[model samples]
Target: MKIHNFSSGPSILPKEVLQKASEAVVNFNNSGLSLIEISHRDPAFVEVLNAARSLTLELLDLKDKGYSVLFLQGGASMEFVRIATNLLNKKAGYINTGNWANNAQMEASFIGEVQEIASSKDRNYSYIPKSIHIPQDLDYVHITSNNTIYGTQYSEFPTVDVPLVCDMSSDLFSRVLDFSKFDLIYACAQKNAGTSGVNLVVIKNDILGKIEREIPNIMNYSKHIEKESMYNTPAVFSVYVSYLTLNWIKDKGGIAAMERRNRAKAHLMYSEIDRNSLFYGTAQQQDRSIMNAVFYLNEPRLTTLFDDWCIKNSIYGIKGHRTVGGYRASMYNALPIESVQHLVGVMQHFEESI
Candidate 1:
């Protein structure tokens, strides 16, 4: 039996997607070669790359004007630095919602001036900060669409006159979004998209020509955009896997369908959390994440006992981050409704056992 993996990253992918990926690993497109061994420059891999890029745009409903998608290596972490180096000239505004958002601010500070417009640090990142005051003169405003660690998400993004850059590492393609609002969006293809190794970047074409700073060709978005994401050898296997995942998304009725399923899963778990006497939902109710539902027990000892119970039941990766000792169930796109139901059963059983 396959274990229900709730890991935040390298997270669960659809079983069909995994099976298809396994076949490709042995004989990609019946090319008589493993996808891992194939040349990135080969026509077969080139088709994979183009399809991946095209499907990403199609799924996001992005048009040609001002937006270009690039499949690059070096996860979203690298883009934290690259975005600052390429875009931040005088000043940039950052919203510190969680660890990843703070990391982006720290990286931007290394390159240039980065102002923290708003932060939820005081609340232990349990809720998204509202009333962010972006500086009028800042070059760009950066926001993390979802806080993976804290289980808080922005239901609606703030309005900014300047260019908007978003680190959508956790929630990319999880729902229908206004891609045109963002001047640049970057995501590590591990959570909802695909496995690790490849980073998907979507940037506005017009914003490419505005960078006056002298940076390496690799750091420049324009370079990758111009070369069709082939400025250098890409993460071919990850890209191909991502393409398969995108196809899976399309087959399952795209983002709208996934959004409905995600909401249903979130409701099942969160409703249990609210109703249970032993457990308490961690994140604010209004800003709770559909991807990661975090909660804690009233009795600290119950936390350990509950974790052990989950493990014995073959439900894994529900332990919360060390920074915040609790439980987090990462219900990514591929986590089945059955798994969420199983978890809810565990929660109910634990209450009865106590």
Candidate 2:
């Protein structure tokens, strides 16, 4: 049986991406070299890097729009520090939506003064707080576009006068959005892009080198740009797979098509959650994430029965995050609607059994 994958982050990837990447692991580009063994400076690997960066810009419609795309090694976790180190001089503002957003603010504090403009933690991050007042004096404002752990998403991004930076790790390329609204957009390539160990960082070309403090060569944005994202050896496999997956996305009608499909999948699962007697959704109606649908069982006694059923039915990684108890079905850009339907069938069947 083909197992359905539902883990959040380092989650599902396109079937074609996985298969092509597997072949390249042994022989990349038929050049008698494994992708892992290839040098970053090699012509073949350079082609992959260029393709990944160019495709990202093309997909986001950021080409020649004062933006530079870089495929960096560290995941989104390290970007919390890199962002602050490069941008934070006097202070910055953050909108805390979940654990990752809060962690980003904490990391920024270690670099410079940071303020929480708004937070939804009091409500257990069930909803996105609208109408946040961004301080005029801050260097930049950071927001996690989607909260993966709590299943809350900003249906509409906050408008601010300052530079709007977003961590789009969980929802990048899963839908269509106004990409130009952000001065800096960073995403770890685990969710909707590629596997882990690579991050896609896009910066508005003019957002660098205003700070008075010294920035290390490695952490500085200008240096990376100058080196063309080749400051050092890169993650060859991750970038190659990311390039292949991006091609897959392009072939599937790009972000517009993904947006429609994602909305349909989310609606299907959330409708089941609302109608079924066994489960209740944790997120607010308007703030539910299209990528992650999180809900919990109303009757706790049926947990084991449902779990056993899931295991027997080839459902994998539907368990919720430990910080928040429940189930999270991460329907990324690559997850077909059939998988969501299969999960809904399981939900309905388990409810009937109960």
Candidate 3:
């Protein structure tokens, strides 16, 4: 039986992507060298890097838009520090929606004055704070597009006067949006892009060189731009696999297609949760994530039975984040509608048994 992967981050990837990545491992481009063995500065590897950068820009409709795309080491976790180190001048504004948002804000506070313009933390991050106030006093406004832990997402982004930055780790390329709205956007490749080695950063060229802080060579966005994301040895296998994943995403008709399919998948699963007697959604209906659909089992006593059922049915990665324990069905770009339907079937069957 095939497993329906619902793992969030370092999560599911397309079968075709997996197959191609596997082939490259043994013999990269028929060069008799594994992708892991190839040097980052190798001309062939350079093409791969360039292609990945170009495709990222193309998918986001950001090509030639003066934005520099960089696939850097360190996950988005590392970016929490890098963002402030590079962009924060006097102050920056952060919206505390969930764990990652708080993490970004905490990291930024270490460098400069960071303000929480709004937050859903008071309610355990079950809902998005709809009433937002953007202060013109800040240098830039930071937002997390989706909360992987609590399952809340911004269906519509705020149009702020300050430069808009987003940590879109979980939901990047999972749907359609106006990419031009953001001055900076960063995401870990583990979720929708590829395995968990490289983090993608897209920053407007004009935003750099404005900060007063002397950024270290490694943390400077402008320096990374100058080096073309090869300041040091890059994550060769992760970047190559990400390149293949991006190719698959483009072949699937870009972000527009992903939006349609992801919407359908989320709707199917959420509808079951709402209708089922055994479960209910943890996040508000309006703010439910199209990528990570989180819910709760009504009766905690049956949790073991349900877990056994899911395992018996070849379901994987449906367990919720340790921060908020229940269930999370992460429907990233690669997750098929059938897998979601299968999970829904499991939910219904369990409900019937209950």
Candidate 4:
């Protein structure tokens, strides 16, 4: 039986992208060398990097907007440090939405002052904080566009006078947004983009050079930009697979089409959680993430039964994070609506049987 993958990270990817990537691993572009075996400086790999960067800008509609795209080593977790090292000259404001948001603030605090401008921690991060007061004195404001574990997303981004930086690791290419609103956006490729090991960072050219701290060459965004994301040997396989996925997104009509598809899946998943008497959603309805639909079984004792049912039906990766124990149906871009329908069918069957 086929598995319905709902893994939060290192999640589902387009089948076509996978097929092409697998082929390249053995023999890239009909050449005898595997993609992983090729030198990072090889002209073919360089073209892939350049094309991927250009495609990212094109899809975000950010071309010629004084923005530069870099697929750098390390994950978004690494970016937390890089972002602070390069940008945090003075204090920065961070909106603590979930675990990742809090971690980002903690990382930045070690570099300089960090103010928790807004937070929903009082409610266990079940909802997004609506009332936010960003201080004008802040060097920049940081936010996680979507909380994968909490299943909450920013329906509308906070308006800030200071430069805006967003860690959109989980929901970067899964929705359509006004990309120009952010001065910097970083995303790990493991979720909607590709496998782990690479992070995509889009920086506005003007955001650099203001900090007085001596940023080491490796941690400096400006240095990475100067080398075009090749300051060090890049994650070759991850970047290539991500390039293929980007091509898939463009061919499928870009971000607008992705938003519509994701909305449909979320609606179906959340609708089941609401309508079914056996279950209820964990996150606030208004702030529910289109990428991750988190819910809980009303009869906690039936957890094992539900897990068994899901596994029997070839449904996997529906378990929630430890912080919020229950279930989380991650409906990413590559997750077909049919999979959501299948999971709903399982929910209905389990409810009826009980």
Residue-wise lDDT of candidate 3 within 1-354, one digit each (tens)? 899999997899999999999999999999999888877889999999999999999999998899999999899989999999988999899999999999999988989999999999888998888769888888899999999899999998888988899999999999888899999999999999889999999999998898888888999989999999998889999999889999999999999999999999998988998999889888988999999989888889888999999999999999999978999999999999999999998888887877
Question: Which is the winner by lDDT between candidate 1 and candidate 4?
Answer: 4
- Residue 188 CA displacement from its true place in model 3, Å: 0.3
Give the CA lDDT, 0 to 100, for residue 280 in model 4.
90
Q: What's the TM-score of every candidate structure?
A: 0.98, 0.99, 0.99, 0.99
lDDT of 2 by residue, 1-354 (tens): 888988897888988999999999998889888989877898888988988999999999999999999989778878899999989988899999999999999988889999999999899999999988878998999999899888989889988888999999999998888899999999999998898989999999898888887888878888999998999888888888899989999999999999999999999999999999889999899999999999998877778888899998899889899988778999999888999999999988888877
Please list all clashing residue pairs in model 4, or write none if there are none.
none
Ranked by TM-score, the better of candidates 1 and 4 is 4
| Candidate 1 vs candidate 2, lDDT winner | 2
- Considering summed lDDT, which 10 consecutive residues are worst modelled in model 4? 126-135
Regions of model 2 farther than 4 Å from truth: none
lDDT of 4 by residue, 176-280 (tens): 899999999999998888889899999999999999999889999899899998999999999998999999999999999999999999989888999999999
- Comparing 2 with 3 on lDDT, the higher-scoring candidate is 3
On TM-score, the stronger of 1 and 3 is 3
Worst 10 residues of 3 by lDDT: 128-137
Looking at candidate 2, what is the lDDT of residue 154? 89
List the global CA lDDT of all models.
0.90, 0.91, 0.92, 0.93
lDDT of 1 by residue, 282-332 (tens): 799999999999888999977678878888888988888888878899999
